[model samples]
Target: ILAGYYILGFSIYSSILLAGLFASQTLIAYPIVNKLGIARDKAVTIAVGGTVITDTLALLLLTVIVGMATGNVDDTFWWRLGISVLVCILIIVVLFPIIAHWFFKLCSDNVSQYIFVLAMVFLGAFLAQLAGLEPIIGAFLSGLALNRLIPKTSPLMNRIEFVGNAIFIPFFLIGVGMLIDYRAFFRDWESLEVAAVMIALITVAKFIAAWLTQKSFRLSKDQRTVIFGLSSAHVAATLAAVMVGYNVILGHTPDGEPIRLLSESVLNGTILMILATCIVSTFATQRGAHNIAVKNALQTNDEEKSRPEEHILIPVANEQSVDELVGLSATIKRAKEPNGLYALHAIDNRVDDPNMEKRARKLLDGAAKTAAAGDLYLQQLLRYDVNIANAIVSTVRERNITDIVLGMHQRTPGSTALPAIPGIPGIPGTSGPGIGKMVTDVLSQSNVTTFIYSPAQPLSTIKRHLVIVPPGAEKEAGFQMWLQRIRQLARNTGAKVAFFASDATLQHIRPRRERKAPANIGFVPFDRWDDLPSLEHDLRDDDCLWFVMSRRDRVSYHPAMSRIPGYLEQVFAGYSAVLVYPVQAGATDRYL
Candidate 1:
C-alpha cells in the first residue's frame, strides 16, 4: 500500500501513513461469520491471525518512519524500539494469559470476571504506552491472551460482546464519524479523486492478498471472499494513524505555508475509504458465508450415508420461552451431530430502541445456556428487520435450516377456551394471531419441516407420542421427512409412537416402520379423517399429541382437521402437543 501510494506521487511520510492505515483493518465481519457458523473455521482463524501479523508489521514500520522523520532515529531509538516491542510481546503473550487463566479459575462471579477483563485491557494499553508503542496493540494482544479463558458460548462471552458491540463500539464509531470533514469533499472536490484512488488501491491490494492466501492455503472461493471482506474494513487503527499524521507538519510549502502531510482532503478521503470498504466488506462476507454454508451442507449430505445430520433452527421471541424452545431442540436433535441446534432471535427493527439488540443477545444467551445444560451446542443467530418472517426465511435458506421449532403464541392457553373461528386454510386456531401469522408465512414460504411445539408440561416426562395423520398426509412430500424427525424424537425419548391414520396411510408407512422402527411405532386405523375429535378421549397426561398436517396449497391438506389446535386446547389441554408442518415444496432436506 505504501509503495502504491508513493508511486502515485504521495510524499514518503504520507505514503507510509496510508500504508499503516490500510494495513490495520477492523474485524467488522466477525459478527456475521459468528452467526454463519464459520467463526471457528480454519480460514477465519487464519484471516484473524493474519490481521495481527500485518498490523504489527505496519505499526512497526510507522514507528520507524516517524522516528526518522522526527530526527530521532539514533542507535538509542533502535535499542528502545526493539526492546520495547519484545518486552510488550513477552508481557502480553506470556504473562497476561497465565494471570488471566489463574484469575478466571479463581473468580466464580461473572461480574467480577467482566470487570477483570476490562482492567486487563486497560492494563495492556498502559503497558504498551510505557513500552513506547500504541495502546491499541496492547489491547489487541490482551484480547488474544484472554481469548481461551472466555468460551464463545459462555455467558461471560455474551456479556462482553453485548457491552462492547452495543455500547462502546457504537460510541467509538460515532466519534470516528464526527471526525470526518464532510465539507472537505465539497470545498475541495479533488478529495473525491483521492478517495477513489485510495479505495481502489486498498480494495485491490486486499483482494490480491486474500486470493494469494486462498491459493496458498487451499481455501475455497467463499472462504477467500470472507477473508477479503473481514480484512478490508479500515476503522480504529486507520483513523488513529491518519489523525496522528494530520497533526504532523512534514515541512513548509514553496510559498512558506505550513504543509500538513495529511490534509483535510486526505483525511476526508480516508473516511470515505473506511465507509466504502465497510459496506463492501459486510455484504461480501454475508454473501460468501451463505455460499460456503450451502456448499458445506451439500458436501455433508453426500458424506452422511450412515446417520443424517439434522440442523434444527429454533426461532425464539419470548425470553421466558427460550429454555423450552432450546431444550426441546436439544432433546430432539441428533446426539451424534456436532453443533446441531441453531437459536435465532429476530429483533423487530420498527421498535426503535437502541438496547433491543442487547436485550436480544441476553435472550439468546439464555437459550444457549439452556442448550449447554443439556450438553448441546447452540449456534446463536441475531437479526434486525421489520419483517421477521422474511428475515427468518432468508436465514433458513442461507444457513440451510432443515427443521424449524417454534413456540406457541402467548394467547394460546387462554384462547383455547374461545370457540374456534375459521383461521388460515391449514392452521388450527384463529386465537394465536402472532404465532399463526409467523407459522403461516414460514411454512408456506420456506422449504423445511416445522414443528410448532406447545409445551403443556415437561417434555421429558411424556412417554407416548400420539400422531394424528390428516387423510392424504402420507402422500405429501414432507410426510417421510416429519416421520423421520418424529422417529428420532421417539427413539431418543424411548417413547411409544401411536399413529392414527387411514388403512392406506398405515400401509404406506408399514414398510418404513418395519425397516426403521417396528418396535417403537404402532399404527391404528381411523377410517374417517374427521374422527380426530374422538381421539381426545384416549389422550393421557403422558401423551404428546402430534398433528402431522400439510401445507395449505398441498394435495394432502384437510379442511376437517383445521380444528386440530382447538381440539388440543379444548379437550387435550392437559397434555403437551406438537403441530407438524411438512417441509415446503422444493426445500432442501439435508439440514433438517
Candidate 2:
C-alpha cells in the first residue's frame, strides 16, 4: 500500500514540477544571462542550451514510466543505460566538435547555421538513445559544440529563438498546468511532507553548488551573491531531469506500478522546489544587479544639457545648384543670429541605372563643401530602396528637425494628366510637390514648421512687403514670433509692411448693439473689396503683400471668391501677395 502511494504521488509531483521547471527556465535565464554582461545573442544561446536538456530528460522519464507499468525493470537495462551515457559523452566531446567545424565552413548564411545546429542536436540525441544513454547529455554536448561554431550575432539564431519563446515555450507551460491535480496535495499529509523535504534538499544542494563554484573562482562578494542567488533557481532542466529519471531510468512493475515506488512523491517535491527557487532567485538577483548598475550609471553623468531652439531641416538634392543652394545658404546667413539650419540629402536607390551612385556622390560632395565653407552643420543620409516620403519623415523625427525645405525642382506641383501640346518640355517626371505634401502632413500630426521655396525666385533680401490677414479670433501666442522674424527680415532689407482685414462682408450681417475692436492692433474694416479705393493706391506703393494665414473658425471662401482666375491675376487686380502661414514656434506639424 505504501509503495503504491509513493509511486502515485511521485508521478503526479514529477508532472507538475517538470512543467514548472521549463517555464521558469526561460524566465530566470533571460535576466541572469543579461546580468552577466553578455550580449543579447550570447545570452539567448546560453538559455537555449540550458532548456535543451529538459526535453531529453522528459523523454527519458516517460520511458522509465512505461517500463514500470509493464514490470520490465532489469539489470541489463541499467548496464545498457550506463553504456549509452558513456557513448554519448565520447561522441559529444570528441566527434561533435570535428563535425561542427566542418559544417560551419560549408555555409555562410544565417538559415544554414540554424539547420546545422538543429541537425547536430538530433544526431546527438539519436546516438545517445542507440547507446542506451540519457539523450539530454547528448543534447547539451551538441549545444556546447555548436556554440563554438556559431557566431553570437547570427540573424538565424535570433529568428529561431524569438519564434520558440513567442510560441512553443508558453504553450508547453500552460499545457503542463492543465495536467496538474491540485486536490492531491491537500488529501495526503505524509506525501506533502515528503515533497517539502525534497524541495528543501534541492534548494540547499543548489545553493551549495553555487557557493562552491564562486569560491573556487575567487569571485568578489557581490558577484558570488548574485551567482548563488541566480543559480538556486531550478527551471526546466531540473524538472525535466527528474521526470526522465522516474519514467525511463526506472520502469514500472508487473502489477502496472511505476518501477520506482517513490516516483510521484519525488516529482511533487521537485515541483515545489522549482517554484520556490525560481521566484526567490529571479527577484533577488535582478533587483540587486539592477540597483548596482543604476547607481554606477548615475555617478558617471558628465554631458551638458542642450538649449531648446527651433530647428529647420532642409533636404537638398544638389548643393551645387547655385540658384537654390546658394540662395538658401545666403538666406540662413543673413537671418538673425542663433538660428538653426540642417541641410539633408537622401541617396535614393530606386533607379536601376548604374550612374545613380555617381550622381548621388557628386551631389553629396557639393553639399559637404558648401556646409564646410559656411561653417554650418549638414546631415547626409543614404537610403537604399526605401519610400522617399517615409525616409524624409523618419529622418525628420530622428534628427528632431522642426522645419523642412526642399529644392524647388522637388517641390513643384505636377499636373494630374499630360498636356495635349507636343514637344513642350514635358513636366519633369520627377517634379512634384510631394515634399510639400509630406511637410503639410507632418505639420498636422506634429508642430513642425515648413518652408517651400521656388528655385527660380529665391529670396535674397527681406525688403519684401508684409501682409497680415487676421481671422478675427483671439490672437495666437505665436503671432509675436512670426512678427519678429518678419520685422527682422524687413530691418535687414529696407522693406515696407501693410496689414489688411476683411470688413466689406461684415455689414451684410445684422448689426449688433455694440462693436468691440481687437486690443493692441488697429484695423480699418470695409464693406467690400471695391469699397476700399485706397487698396489699389496702397498696392502701387508697396513692392509685395505678405499675407499671414492663421487657423480660425470663421475663414471660409465664398463662391464668388472660388472662381477668381489665378493667384497672379487676383494680385494684379490690386496688390502682389506673398502669403505667409503663421505656425507656433518650434511646433512640429505632420502635413502628410
Candidate 3:
C-alpha cells in the first residue's frame, strides 16, 4: 500500500499510513481454507506464515513512521524499540510453548485446556503491547509456538476452531460492519474515489505477490487463486492500523489543528473494500479447493496419482481380535502410500459406566501396539456416541477412509431378534444384535469398501484366498475399488486368488485383470448366480472365504441375500470369512 501511494506521488506520511493500514488484515478466510481440507497445502501455508511476518514488520514500520513524523526519531527511540522486540520474541517463541506443553500435560480435562489457551492469547497480547508492537503479532507467535503440540485432528483443535468461527470471529466482522456509516459515503463522492483507488492498489499488489509466489513455488493455478484470495481480505490488523492513524497521526492538520486524518468518505470506502475482498476470498477458495479435489479424483489410474494413500480403519471391539484385524489391514494396505491404519473404538454415549473411555483407550492402545510390532504406523480414534455405528460412519467420512476392516460379530443372548418380515428385499431373518448390528449399519450407511473378517484360525496360517462375486456384483459402483483391493491383498500375501463369478461378471473381470494386471488373479466361472450356495463344497480349512456382497437396493442385491447372516452362522461358523462391500455408485464426492 505504501509503495502504491508513494508511486502515485502521495506525501511520505500518507504513503506510510496507508502501508500500515494495509498490513492489518482480518484473515477472515482462514475457516474457508480449513473447510477445503487444503489448510496444510503449500500455497495456503505460505500465505498464513507470511501474515506473521507482514503484520510484525508493518507494526514496526508504523512506529518508525510515527517517530519520524513526530520528531522522536532518536538513538533512545531505536534502543527502546530493539530491546522491546527482542524481549517479546524471547517470551513468545521460547517460553510460551514450554509453559503450554507443561500445562496441557498436567490437565486432562478439555475445559482447562481451552481456558489455558485463551488465557495465553490475552497474555501474548498484553506482552506485545508492552513491547511497542501490535498485540496481534504476539498472538501470531504464540499460535506458531503451540502449533506442533496440537494435532489438527485432535478435539482441542476442533474446539478452538469452533469457538473462533462460531462466536468471536462473527462478532468481530459485525463490529467491522457497524463501523461503516453509509451516510458518510452518501454525503461525499470523494469517499467513493478513495475507496476505488485504494481497493485497486491493494487488490493488484496482492495478485502480483501471489503470482510471483506461484511462479517461484511451481504451484498450480488453483493454488495461486487460493493464495491471492487469502491475502486480499483486510480486517483486524487493517482496522487497528487505521484507527491508530486516524486518532494519533492522520488526525492532525499541517498547521497542527486537530481534525480527522481519515475523512468519513475514506473510512466508509475502506469498509466497503473489506466487504468486497472478503466475498471474493470466500468464493475463490471454495472454487479452488473443489478443483483440487476433482483433479485428484480424475487421475487416469491409481498408479498415476502421487503414490496412492490408503486410509484403512480397523474398528476394534475386542482385545482378542485386535492383532488379527491390524495384521489384515497392514497386509492389504498399499505399500507405497505414506498413511497407516487407524484403530477406532466407538463406545455408546448412553453408557453410564465411567470406565468406558478408559477401557476404550486401553483397547486402542492394544491395537496400536499390535500395529507397531508389525512395524506399521497406527492412529487411534476413540469416540463416545449414542450410536456406535453412526460414530464409525462419521469417522469414515472425516478420515476419508478407503477401506474398513472389522471383526465378524455374533449375536448376543440378550440382543434383539431379526425382524420376522425383514425391512428390505433379499435377506430374511438375517439380522442380529451387538457386533452384527454395528457391521450391518456401517455396511448399509457408508460408501467406503468394508471388510468383515472372522478368523477361525490365525490369519498367518491361511494358505489360499477364495473370492466370491455374486451375480450382478460387477454392476456395483465400487466393484473396481474392491477388486483392486483383492488384487493388492493377493499380491501382498503371495497367495493365489481363486475368483468365482457368473459368466457375465467374468467379462468385466478379464479386462480389469489385463488393465490392472493384478498378481495371481484367476477367474472360475459359475454358470448360475443362484448356485452361490454350492461354493461350500470348495471351501476348506486352509481357504479364507471372501464374499463380495452388495448393500440392499444396490444393483447386485438379491432377495435371498438377507439369508447371508443366518447362512454364515449355520454353515461357516468355524471358518474364517470376509464380507466385502464395494464402493457405492455416484458417491465420488467423498472419495478423497
Candidate 4:
C-alpha cells in the first residue's frame, strides 16, 4: 500500500489491490528444489506452509476489495463471507471425497477417470463463484482433494502431472505475454518507473519476510534463501488481482473517460516484475538445493556405513502372489542396493509330476518381471530337494539371507481354511491343511525374519496400515531391523501407521518413530490380543493389517497369535494383511 500511494498516488482501493497482488506468490522455482530431491527438507516445507497462508490472505483481500467496489462492504458481508467459506469447505473436503470414491470404485476406465477429475475441477470453480472466491483457488482445492485419494507413484497422478507441466504451465506463460504490452513500456516513462519501483519493493518485501521467518524459527541461511526464492515469483494470482482491479471502474474522468482502479501501465509493469523475479528466484533456489543435496548425501553415506548389508530372499510358491510379495520386498529394500532381491522356487524332487518344473520356471519368470519394473535385480535360484521346507531353510543359510517373504499357507484350490474346526481343536488356525505343515516347519527350522503375506487387495491402493505389535516385541533380536524396515515402508508408500501395542513397547517405539518419520504415525495403547475380533469396525478396504507375530519358543510369543491364520483366512480375509515373524536369538540359521 505504501509503494502504491507513494509511487503513483493511487486511491485507497487501488492501493489495496496492488498490495494484495504483492501479497500472493506462485512457486515457480519449486521444480528446482524438487528435482534436487530436497523438496522435503524442513526449510522447503516451511516455505510451503507460508505460501498456503499468504495465498489465502491475498485471495481474501481480493474478495473484500471486490465487495467494497460494488458497495457491499458491511458487517453482514463479513458474516456471509465466513459462512460461505464454511459451506465451500464442507462441500469440497467432506462431500467431494465420498462422491469421487464412489465414482472411482464403480468406474475402471482410465480415460473416464481423467474426465471425471477434470469435471470436478470445474465444479469446484462453480462452487467458488457462489462463495465469492476465484476459480484458480477452487481448482487448487480440487487438486488438493485428489492428492489424498491418489498416491505419487500412481499412474493417474503421473499423467496429471505430465499434462499440467507440459500444457498448463506453458499456456499460463503465454497468457502472461498476452497481458504485457511491450510498446507501452517503450513509449511511457511511467511504465518503466512503475516496473523499477514495483520490482525493488517486492524483492525487498519478500526477502524481509523470509529473513524474519528464519530468525523467528532459527533456520539456516541456505534455508532462508530457499524460502525467499520460492516465495518471490508473483505470477498467477498477482495477474488475477491486476486484471480484476483494472476492470473495476468507480467513476469517470473529466474528459468523458472511465476512471479505472488501475491504469494499463501498472499491468504492463507487473509482467516485467514477473520476469525479473522468476529469474532471480531460479538462481537462488538452485544454490539452496545444491547445498541441501550435498548435506543429505553425507548423511546417507554415514547411515549406510552403520546399517548391515541387506539381502532379502522371497520364497515363491504361488505364481499369482509372486508380484505382491516381491513388491513388498521392494518397498523395504534400500534403493542403493542392487541384486538385493532373490526369488527362490524349491522343486519338490519327491513328487513325480511332469508339469511341476515348468510351473516353477513360470513363477520365477513372473517374479523377475515384477522386480525389474521396480528397478531391482531378482536373482532366480532353483533348488531341487526332497523336503520343500528344508529346501527353503537350506537356501537361507547358503545365501546368508536376513529376511524372507512367503505366501500364507500356500493357498489350496478350494480351501477356505477357517479356524476352530470341529475335528482340529487345538489352535486350529495355526495350520489349515496341505501347506500349513511346510510353513510351520520353515518357521521352526529357520530363525530369519519371515513375512507371511495374505493380500486381499492391491498393495498400491492401501492408504493406511494397522500394526499390532506384541507385548515383548521390543526384546526380540530383530527388533531394530524390523523397525528400520517399517520406517522405510512408511517413507516409500507415504501411508500412515497406527501401532497398537502395550505401553512398554510403545515407549520403546516412540523414540525411533520421532527420529525417523515423526509424522503420520500414531501410538495406541492396546494389549488385548484376545479381543482381536473387535477391530472389525476400524478395518477399511484401503487399510493394510500388520501383525508382528513371534516364534512359539521366543520371548514375545503369545497363545493368541495362533488365531492369525484363522483371521487372515476367514475374518480379515477381505483385507491385505502381513504377519511378521522377527528373527529370534539363538534360533537363526539352525541348520547351519
> How many clashes in each structure?
1, 55, 11, 0
> lDDT: which is higher, 2 or 3?
3
What ranges in model 4 sit over 4 Å off? 35-37, 70-80, 103-116, 247-259, 308-427, 431-449, 457-463, 512-517, 534-542, 570-573, 585-592
Clash pairs detected, candidate 1: 402-592
Report the Cα lDDT for residue 365, model 2. Answer: 60
- RMSD to the hidden true structure, all candidates: 18.0, 26.0, 16.9, 4.5
User: Candidate 1 residues 37-60, lDDT tens each?
Assistant: 666566788888888887777767
Q: Against the true structure, whose TM-score is highest?
A: 4
Looking at model 1, residue 210 earns an lDDT score of: 94
Residue 202 in model 4: shift from native, Å? Answer: 1.8
The list of candidate 1 runs beyond 4 A from truth reads 1-8, 251-257, 301-592
Question: Is candidate 2 or 3 superior in TM-score?
Answer: 3
| Candidate 4 overall lDDT versus native | 0.80
Candidate 2: 10-residue stretch with minimal lDDT: 557-566
TM-score of 2: 0.42
> Per-residue lDDT of 526-568 in model 2, one digit per residue for the tens?
3333232234555442244444443322233122221111222
Clashes of 4: 0
- Model 3, 1-592: lDDT tens digits are 4453554445667567776766655556777766555565678778887877787787788777766766778879999999999999899888997788667645645577778888888899889989888787778778877765553433466588778879998898899888887887778676677777778878888889989999999999999988888888887777776666566543556888765444455567678888777887778777876787567557645664634468899998888788778767866775434356899998887788878888888999988876654446799998888787888889988998888999888666776666543443433376334237677677667788889888766554455788878888877878878877876676555556788888888888775436344436778987544544566888876678888877666788766556665566665566678888788775333333
Error of 4 at 76 (Å): 6.1
